[model samples]
Target: MQGKLYAIGTGPGASDLITVRAARLLDKLDVLYAPAGRKGGRSLALSIVQEYLGEAVQIKERHFPMTADATQKQQAWDAVAADIEQDVKQGKQVGFITLGDSMLFSTWVFLLERLSDKIDIDVIPGITSFSAIASQAQFPLCMEKQSLAVMSCTADADALRAALNSHECVVLMKVYGRFTQIRQLLEELDLLDHAILMANASMGSEICYPDLRLIESGEDLPYFSTILVNRTWALN
Candidate 1:
């Protein structure tokens, strides 16, 4: 009798944004695995869902190093997968929580790839940060037949430029430290006025800048910061 593993999305930083399905599962799951940046760093996913969890629910934090080194990342994933495998083998239903949707720019991707063959896996989707941001900013991501492209802010300038030119709307995720560079490129392409910056979307302290020119260079932003660029759309 092998237990199951669920990859649950806890949604963007809000406690109320968690899906009904994810909330029910979080209440019933035997163990919850949360990803942390360092050994003892706080888990954003866990923080989002903590209010719904009971006292008896077991929570486990696994370190996922924020690095470009493939070997270090692989090692961390392998170790976490092994732990999850043991729990499943013992007939304990384990839940892994991720911020935003499980399939989109999530750490659950690596875990699922490593454990899919070895166990029964279920994925529960949740609201994305950008969607929440758009709502908060009163902006439309796309309308009619307009196309949208979602990419990382860390992507090379060429790729970012191409996305800006090709897509009617482009979403740049993880825009914390690279906001300046991204804004510069948008200016070069004459799309700065059409861009908006959102940080900590849906959470307390949420900030939105419809005008990117107001953001000074070299300013530090939260990890959840994002930028939405629309070539032919405006919030007005």
Candidate 2:
């Protein structure tokens, strides 16, 4: 019999926020795949689900380099796919965990595209980082018919400006190294005060900045950081 593959979302840095479905799958899965930036780096996704898994479960930490090089990323994805394919072909239940929703800006997206034809796959959704941060910060994402746009901080400046001008709310993901640029744009648009910057949302070290200008210009942020801009609402 062919084994199944599960792409599970562990939620935004909070263990309790993980869905019951994802937790049950983690408990029973034979092999678990967690992503890390380096060989020995810690995986936030794995940390969320580690307590739910027992000694019988096998854990695999796969390295996914943080780079814009397409060739390097493809090579890494290929290797990970091969590893997962090997376990699946042997009829071993495999599970891959990602922070936030697996369908949203996840490494699982690439893996699924590569493995969809080779094995049966199931996806379990979890709360997204933006939603968790918004909830924790008491910031409303949208209201009535207001539209919301989510984009990466690496997006083109003009496009980002257009988005800010058009949408009532905008979420900029992966804002770690690009905070200064984003802050500049927000200030130019007179939307700086409308933005809320969050780092490690829902985690123990989570930090929220209602005033974007308060953050130092050259400060480094975590990979999990996000900036939520809501023109419809602003802090007093």
Candidate 3:
């Protein structure tokens, strides 16, 4: 009998937010592989799902570098995938947890690409940070006849501008690094008044900025920050 691999999304950051299916899978995992962003950093995803993990579950916490160097990232991904593949081949049920949805802007995507052909992979979806943010902020992402665009701060200026102009609402993910620039652009588009910024959504550190103008010019938000702009609604 061959072991199966599961890619579970642990949800935005809350433990209770985990799906029932994901919870059940967590309880049955023989080995849990958690990825940390830095060499010595703790796995935040593991923290979110630790309560559901079985007592006998083997925890394998590994570091995946967050950098622009493709060679380093490729090497780390290859090594990690190899380890997981080997474990699955040995008939040990393995699981990997990711934050938000596994398919969206996640490291799980790379793992899936490498291991899909080698093993039976099951992807268990979970709540996304933006979805939790909208709930916490009492935000309605869209309404009838209103289109929504989801983007990232890393996007080029033209694309960002186009999204803002074309969509009734725009969600900007990973906006911390380019907060100032994005904020300025929103101001230029006269959409700043319609926007809100949220950091660490659903987590204990969660903070919602109903008015983006309230943030100082040099202020830096957490890496988990996001911004939502709705031309149809003027945020406080």
Candidate 4:
């Protein structure tokens, strides 16, 4: 029997937010893998779905560091992937859970790259955090002939600014720490009023506030935060 690997997205924050298909698969998975929190803490995804798992099923929590060092991140991811590979080799159907969509800014991406050659990998798409943000904020991403660009605010600020100017809609993911810097740039461009910041979208903690007028400079933000920029054309 060929073992199967699934990269599963748990959606924003709510257990019910997980897709029906993903939920079904989760119930059937023989082994589940999730990134661990600091010092053996349970992953948020695991906690959300813990009730659904059978006692017979196994859960593997892999702790990863929160660091910008490429070597550290790569090593941790590789170790996790190796562990997943070990489970698959033993003929177990493994489900790896991630917050938000598996493909969007997910640690699963690194695992996929590492294990693609050795395992039969399939990804189950879940509603991304941005989708929840848009729905909650009642945002229209883009319209006919207009383009939508989804990127990280952690990237070059100048490049992001250029994209906002060129695209009809810009969804900035990973905008947690750089909110103030990005907001300042937007303010200078007279675009702050047109943008919306979505924090902890679709979760119990979700907040959708228009304009950065209320957000403090360099305020510590959560990982679930995102910023949506509606180009002037979107005002039509």
Stretches > 4 Å off in candidate 1: 37-41
- For model 3, how does the per-residue alpha-carbon lDDT over 136-225 read when each residue is reduced to its tens digit? 988878998889999988989999999999999999998977988999999999998889999999888988889888898888789899
Q: Which candidate number would show the highest TM-score if scored against the true structure? A: 3
Q: What residue pairs are clashing in model 4? A: none
TM-score for model 2? 0.94
> Stretches of candidate 2 above 4 Å error?
37-39
Model 2 Cα lDDT, one tens digit per residue, 145-168: 999999987888888999999999
| Residue 177, candidate 4: alpha-carbon lDDT | 68
Q: By TM-score, highest first, what's the ranking?
A: 3, 1, 2, 4
Candidate 3 residue-wise lDDT at 104: 86
Give the whole-model CA lDDT for all candidates, comma-separated.
Answer: 0.87, 0.89, 0.91, 0.82
TM-score of 3: 0.96
TM-score of 4: 0.91
Lowest summed-lDDT stretch of 10 residues in model 1? 35-44
Per-residue C-alpha lDDT of model 4 across residues 123-194, encoded as one tens digit per residue: 998788778887888887888888888988878888888888898788888887677788888778777767
For 1-236, candidate 1 gives per-residue lDDT tens digits of 56999999988889999998888888888899998644575777888998888668898887788889999989999999999999999999899999899999887899888999999999999899889988888778888989999999888889989999999999999887788888889889988878898998998889888888887786777777899988787543
lDDT at 74, model 4: 93
Predictions: Cα RMSD each: 1.6, 1.5, 1.2, 2.2
